[model samples]
Target chain A: METFADSLDTPSVVVDLDLVRANIRRFQAYADANGFKVRPHIKTHKLPLIADMQIAAGAIGITCQKVSEAEAMVAGSSAITDVLITYNIVGAEKLARLAALARKVRLSVVADSADVVDGLSRTFAGEASPLRVLVECDTGANRCGVASPEDAAALARRIAVAPGLAFGGLMTYPPAGGEAAVQDFMSKAKALIEAEGLTVPVITSGGTPTMMHAAEAPVVTEYRPGTYVYNDRSLVMRGACGWDDCALTVLATVVSVPAANRAIIDAGSKALTSDLLGLTGYGHVLGRDDLAIDQLSEEHGRLVSTGPIGLKVGDRLRIVPNHACVVTNMVDEVYLIEAGQPAPRKVPVAARGRIR
Target chain B: METFADSLDTPSVVVDLDLVRANIRRFQAYADANGFKVRPHIKTHKLPLIADMQIAAGAIGITCQKVSEAEAMVAGSSAITDVLITYNIVGAEKLARLAALARKVRLSVVADSADVVDGLSRTFAGEASPLRVLVECDTGANRCGVASPEDAAALARRIAVAPGLAFGGLMTYPPAGGEAAVQDFMSKAKALIEAEGLTVPVITSGGTPTMMHAAEAPVVTEYRPGTYVYNDRSLVMRGACGWDDCALTVLATVVSVPAANRAIIDAGSKALTSDLLGLTGYGHVLGRDDLAIDQLSEEHGRLVSTGPIGLKVGDRLRIVPNHACVVTNMVDEVYLIEAGQPAPRKVPVAARGRIR
Candidate 1:
């Protein structure tokens, strides 16, 4: 029998459907047992099929980083009525797209600055359906969002007063291992918003590393964890998931055994990506912990052996990259490996390359 | 009048057609005067239109790293009869594809090990025409290829004797600033191959940083420079080309100005790529050398100001990424900016995800 693993091309992204389903069910069950609505971020897989699977597994909605990404998911699944775009949408083209997307789905966006909210207000004014806006709070992430809770409350007040824009609570993507700070910040911001006669309905806080502890934040009503659908080396290093839980991998072939203790694979920075995620090497070679992907060019991955590696040319190896989300975006299509199936199903990465 | 720059979507790969034509002509002229064949690598751009442009500008053939990439280019241009695949083609699927490609075009491949040549020989045996094989020599570049000159000659002899395989010559992707070493190695390998009653028809050696000094290596008959057509920040830092010579840039919009020194752009690692290429930042912000793209999430690029940056939300900035080739592979489509065209023409990246 020609198995799917044997027939597929080299340097391809393979997702184990069994593992993906298990991951989705595991996270959904955790959220259900607690009192949180799970809104999985589609940025990890960037596939409409995967997003649909997530929504079918009890997710309240989907979360996307870009307007085009949200549009892609919404177009794929009629069940995906609610979408939260976590990045600020700028420019006339993107704002118009956002407005159009809002007309189709229950769309809400996050903004930390007055300019972004003002732009959204102007674009959505005098529409039959008002646009929902959430104040993005920086709870120790320090990446994007308002720095202080007072700023978050002020932004909420601004959204409440802005025409054709309804204040839709607060959202925060806290730093890994900083769930307590997120709780403190969200509670303070909610209190301030309530004091200003604004109703805070949804308080979203999430990061894959701290997803299990999300219910500890009593004020958080929704959680958005993207990478839990397909764990990676970074997640494993953070003690978030076991090695067996890594569902996605880059199946690369050893193209050249140039010298002793050195081999080259077809997967390079273009496939494995250059996001170190604080790890030492590029990726983890499955079943060969002694081998290290020490260097990468655009199309060549250099694998250095820490110990004796008995790999030869044409040998295929599955590598768990440092970050799964970035790897998903690098490729156009991925194979879904179903258990006991002879051929894997190919899935198009629908929401990929949607940086706008 | 609306300019092409103003009409483009944020975080797009924009290529200046004039600069691309100038770059191709300049490199081809240099190689023509130096008595070398300019077989430009298509991995930099991966578009059939760009490959056709290179052939129109006097490129002898096209060089690709994967079989599918070569197939895409060959399918696009009938003029692209000769293609040099610089990576080892492994597995039954790829070998069959290689055989099919060989039947269509004058295909040649590089191999460093006996196993690869054996596989190719088995796959191409009994065909009407034999497949050409080149011994890949590692001349200071420790990535792939035989380590010693003797090994290169041995591989050449092996391919010469193998059924359905003809010994073409030698090929090497030398380390940057190692032109003398490549010359010495190729000369020694050529003498050994000749001593075995074999003809050294062609010797190819190239890398963008050392392309200008290619003529110093008298034994090299062909040069393959992938990044010369679209110079990037790395090429500029290495003094290979001036900043103005760069033909590609990622147009990004500032989406958030959260702090005094921090501004966030819509282009993140997905668009700009994490290829530092030994540089300090992810990319060079055009006209703003003081600002640094110090951090990158999947969808957010964090720009930190050395001093005060007067950038506001919705301001668009063109960033010259550290590595243009990787950035080209990241996006699905790129815009071609002509000097007189009001709007840049959109070109789909035909061979973007052809990793196999």
Candidate 2:
């Protein structure tokens, strides 16, 4: 029998629905048993259908990285009533959109600096409901957020006193293998915030690699895991999830068998993405561990064989890309593969290109 | 007076229409003077409006990488009559789409293997007009193409004798400094094919780095240059075009100034892309040679300064990415900056995700 995956075109994203639900239930069950709220990041699978599935499986809310992404999720389904934008919201246009989205849903934003908080204050000063704000602590990520617990406390105090803003808590996206540091950082920040006569209702820390050990940080009230819904090669390499748990795979055809050792596929950087994530090569070809995607142009993926390979043109292969979040943003539609279905149903990546 | 670019959102693609026209005319003029046909690759801009502009400036046709992309261009505008898909067409779905598109326009495709040609021949066998096919030859890129002149001749002969196929000629995407080898390979292939009583009408060779030296190869009758329309940092590094010749820039906002020398922008891999292309960092921060975009997540670009920088929160910066072709594919829309316009006109990237 021809499966739904077999009927799709080359260079398409095929998501196994069974694996998606299983991954979601497993993560949600872990979070539930650990007394932590699960706010799944929608950036991994930028689809409302998947977000709805996450919410139905006992998620507190959905975490988005951009205002437009939050808006797309809210517009796609009413189940996403609570949204936490994890990026520093800046500029008048984005602030206005943020304010409008806050009016429609329980919206909260993160800010590492006072300028971002000031912008939020000016945008929502006279609104009926004050906007919730979280001070982002660095927690060893060294990317965004305040450096020390003192800075986090100061930013939280600033957000507390800002007009039409409520200091929600502290949030951090720690680096991989920095769970111990995150625990120490968040504990110190929580103590500092409590010393200032403020209650830290929520201390959220997240990273796919450190998600399993999230409970090790006693101060964290919630965990936001994005890649768990659709595990990728990066997650597999980090030992966060096994290879069999990967729900998403890019279906591609070997368009050209140029030589005995080199086969080119239709998927390229535009499909699989160029986010190496400190890994060598591009992606892992399923059922062909010997073949490595050595190179990629915009529209062609070069798969090189480690040994003699019997691949030919027109042969189809599925690849687990290094990073699934960036790949989700690359395509407008993805195929949903369900067991016993005649064909995979096409779902619009509703939040794709919503990188405002 | 604020310019159109100043009034728009951050992390958006701002294309200077004047520079786009100038770049198109400059390359077309060079190709015209040197007796080479100009078939601008639509994968760079992916907009029918830009494709129409290239055709108006004297391009013989447009080159596409996928069947869906060609379909989008042909459906968007009537100016794109001739489309040369430089990738091999495979599968029943894509072959049917290729046959349908061939009926609408002057369509031709390239194949490096017998399987691809056989699929194309099977799809177009009973059609009124035979589909044109070109044998893609490997001139040293070693990505996708026939191995040698002998293989190229054999594929050309197979394509010529196929039921509903016409041998167009030879095509290649030569490596950046491989002009001499391309000349040698194409000349020998042309002679071999001619010995079999087949006319090599179009010997198409292209690459932005080797575009200026394309005329050095006497056998190449046509050139397809994609990134020349919006020159990037890679092109600048190769001495193909100057920094001032670059027409595309990603307008990003400094969302947070965490430290004295560290600034974070709202654009990341989703905007700038992760195509290092053998260069360090993500992109060239325009006007700030002292700053480097050292890291990128999905929505955050980390700019670390080599010295004391004057940039602050909410300040905007323009970046010239390393690869313009991949960056263009990441966005759904781009702002067109025309002279004297109060607001930059927004145009949908008509063929953004047509990776079928």
Clashes of each: 0, 0
In the predicted model 2, the residue pairs found to clash are none
Q: Which interface RMSD values do the candidates have, in the order shown? A: 1.0, 0.9
TM-scores for every predicted model: 0.98, 0.98
Query: RMSD, each candidate, Å?
Result: 1.6, 1.3
lDDT of 2 by residue, B122-177 (tens): 99998999999999999989899999999999999999999999999999999987
Which numbered prediction scores highest in TM-score against the true structure? Answer: 2
In order, the first chain's TM-score in every candidate is 0.98, 0.98
Model 1 docking tier (incorrect/acceptable/medium/high): high
Clashing pairs in 1: none
DockQ of each: 0.80, 0.83
Docking class of 2: high
Model 2 chain A worst lDDT window (10 residues): A1-10
Residue range B1-356, candidate 1, lDDT tens digits: 12776888798999988889999998899999999999999999998888889999888889999998998888877788999999888899889899999999899999999999999999989788999999999998899999989999999999999999999999999999888998899999999999989999889988889798999998999999999999999999998998889999999999888888999999999898888888888899988988999989988999999677789998989999999998989888999988777788998888887888
- Give the DockQ of candidate 1: 0.80
